[model samples]
Target chain A: MSTNATTEIVPGWETVIGLEVHAELATATKLFSGAPNRFGGEPNTNIDPVSLGLPGSLPVLNEKAVELAIRVGLALHCRVQRSVFSRKNYFYPDMPKDFQISQYDLPINGEGWLELADGRRVGIERAHLEEDTGKSTHVGGGGRIHEADYSLVDYNRAGVPLIEIVGAPDLRSPEDARAYVSELRSILVAIGASDGKMEEGSMRVDCNVSVRALGETELGTRCEIKNINSLRSLGRAIVYEARRQVDLVTSGGRVEQQTRHWDEAEGSTHKLRSKEEAYDYRYFPEPDLVPVEPSDEWIESIRAALPMLPRERRRRLADEAKIETAAAALTVERGMDDLAVEAIGLGADPVRVLVHLENNLADGIGSLSAGPFAALIAMEVDGNLTSTQTKTVLAVLVADGGNPAEVATELGFEAMEAEELEVIVDSLIAEHPQDWLAFTSGDDKERKKKAGFFVGQIMKVTGGQADGRAVNELLARRADA
Target chain B: MTEYTARQRISRSEVAHVADLARLSLTDQELDAFTNQLAAVLDHAADLEALDLTDVEPMIHPLPVHNVLRPDVVGETSDRNEVLSCAPSIENEQFRVPPVLGESP
Candidate 1:
């Protein structure tokens, strides 16, 4: 995909998107009770009185869930505050209790920013603690909710801890929204706050998108698109919805504030309800549960115990290896940045190590120590082995533990002598004089294309034993002469 | 002045709206009675609202307590058959509810 979106998604208009990501906390018990917070069970097997919302069942806050929530807040650089739980009242059968226990006025985390791989920082409004509701399956023709004959509810997920991390309206494009969610998911997984699994409903996203004329300070009536499970769906839904709103305004209609469901199959959104028809969730503080006041000492201890987050790790590798944060981010996320750093420390070329890490080791480095890895790169760097031979030996080293030199010898792979490379390159150039003319005097694109042709012939003659870099240098030098 | 403000504070339609939110189908007579009753309740609290509370911090809890928590551990879950049978409707080891209206938040 192109790095940046096209100039005008809709001409003379821009999109403002704020995403609410709800990640279920990884805790053994429910947020407000000991109901065995397991994902899948035989329907009601995980339910207790609290989860079922039986009359007179009181809620007890889970300490581990709070700690995980605090870990999330600290990892995201939000101000962990003394937060209170409120009862968000609405008519939902999934929540056996008429109201969902959540934080409204005060959230545990506030005002954090997640930095994308491109270094654009998206503002986080707040991450408030809440309880997840039960799962409902509409059991009728087409499984559509409104038209279903009946619905079945499983209380297994009810009362499980969740943190709804709300992002500021800082995104201007669907791609930016995806980047924000991706970076946030990485951070969530790094901190062990949530598994960040969208497929299993562990992390869900709701996007509030508004479009207005460019350079207009005020925002248009935003529509909320709900439950986009995957990153692709999030991006596509935003694009479709934004364009729909643009078409509506351009065709002399006003955009309405509504909760719309993303129809993945149709590639559009369907309106669930409008603002006037929206539920008046009368929010009030829960008298059952008190404010969660984590002391400064406790919060400091949690901050101390947090692992180095993904962004910080990316920055560390980028600085140490002198690579772009974008490339460093991929290496770090793949759990290979440390190996790359160690190889760089052993005097191996940092850029080459990153390239091999990104391309060659996609499966993973697998039991290969940094010592052997560094030695392999070092051989290629010192011209003792060609790029292809180095890759073959590195594969052997990565798959089965072996010395770089022994592996190269076992495979009968060696760098062509510089004079041998010269002979091959001189022959190829003579054979393709027309192409060589283009290589020497053609435009920049043509010169690059012809250089690739000569290099391919040299590699074929040497049976992948010739260094492509050496081939290019010889071709350029011959052309100059 | 008290009667006028009390009528303004609670309208019959507002009472009916609250009843609708609670999923209660109230009669016109019931709405009228509830409106006056709610207004009287608000009238009682009106004396407190008029106080100069600028210097006072809003109390979230009557008792000065906070941070009640329990350890995360797998504990006793209610017997499935027992709870499912008690539900108004049960199907396939799950609680069967009528066609639901709102999405879970």
Candidate 2:
């Protein structure tokens, strides 16, 4: 775990990075065909002739992909415009279509900004809608494409709608790059536009890395690093690639403009292909598809459909409650912002609710909805149960759905009466005469420590259901006497 | 009938690049022949520049309808067994092809 501490690279070189993130839209059908667009289907099952690029088959645009593209645009604060589809001519078996239908000069969304958790904003150059390709499974030696004896293609993923979000070279550190992807993923998931699962290939990142001398306005030659499948690997790849570029320049070798594949096992980037004047894609308008002239009304409707985005929700939660930054980020990241807000609205303490949510979200929320969970916390707050008793009731409620009060009774946790608690505290003090003497005779510091020790001992006898505040009152009276 | 004058000759290397992009293996003679043939076709289409249509909007398709989009609805998908049957070879129900030189491992 590398802390976000600034590490000077070769003393003077600063890393400049931009990222292109390709996210598969959560649509029901392919971008241009009616074939089912889903993940993990039987190989080639989710494909049709249009997705398979068969002869004489024409493509009909899936309106859902367009709506999702606009939803992302609005969430990212981008300019949604009348966009056109063009053929990005390329050769790959993954795209059975000789040319991919992508937005070239005019994308649907343009020029947005995404703010990271630490308030660093990266500029989004464009988020263009395009079609994804089929999955290729390589067989034989090393399982790498260059060494494979044969390969398999699964068209199940083919023609899935995608939006390639291009970012400006605003990320300065490797950690910022990771934050940028994570922040973007949260926003995508928030808007319900994408699942944003990098491991599942629903969201993929291509990093463009360069290094320049400190305070230099011009950028050094950059390399595009691909195949980083996780957020940790995304950060590691940028750091390694940036260092590699710095080493190349310092050692008097010019950094070549190329595409590099990040080898996760080796932890280094190897040259995939050197660019020969930046890929002449020879883009032209797709004669099969019509222009996407979005009406203002349609764009407004899409914007209205978007939920509260991640950044706005984070800011609002931070302002409304004095939640710590990390806890607030987690609350928003896991789609718990609304729950936290609703729980707070229902008179639960904001900080405690968010803390409990952050701590207990691992094994899934189970059957504990915010209303009931808030009720459980309220019970603890009102001295009906101790914190330990509350946690027990919460666990039972989550594991087995029931009213928190009912579960508390079933767990045999009832608030101890004040008189009973005082009697129990008196008995414990008599049993531990020296400790009780220290509590009454010692200074305030020793009193606090001894009181804490007594509280632990009393909790054990009470089965962790005794209220500590009541115990404190009884002990303070004994000391006064 | 008016004849379209030839201009902007296509280079043989350009032809070869296009063929490579299309994943076609072409010989030198085939590249030369394609260069001349594609150049003539482009030159003839260049006759469209002779017309003055500055006021015209660029039409993407010949169909009368614009925004010919299907509703965002899920429809019937082909059966997996039926779709995989169309492939030349299948392993684990996926289409098997000769390993391409540059693909994700």
Q: After superposition, how far is residue A143 of candidate 2 from its true place, in Å?
A: 2.1
lDDT of each: 0.86, 0.83
DockQ of all models, two decimals each: 0.72, 0.48
Docking class of 1: medium
lDDT of 2 by residue, B1-105 (tens): 222225446777778887876679998877766777787788777788788989998765566556668886766666768867877888988878887876541
Error at B50, model 2, angstroms: 11
A95 in model 1: Cα distance from truth in Å? 0.9
Residues forming the 10-long window of minimal summed lDDT in candidate 1 chain A: A1-10
The digit string of per-residue lDDT tens for model 2 on A180-234 reads 8999998899889999999899999999999888878798899999899999998
Backbone Cα, N, C clashes tallied per candidate: 0, 0
Candidate 1 structure quality by residue, lDDT tens digits, A15-99: 8899999999999999988888787678888888999899999999999999999998888778999889999998778888788
lDDT (Cα, 0-100) at B45 in candidate 1: 90
RMSD of 2: 4.5
DockQ of 1: 0.72
For residue B4, give model 1's deviation from the true position in Å.
Answer: 6.3
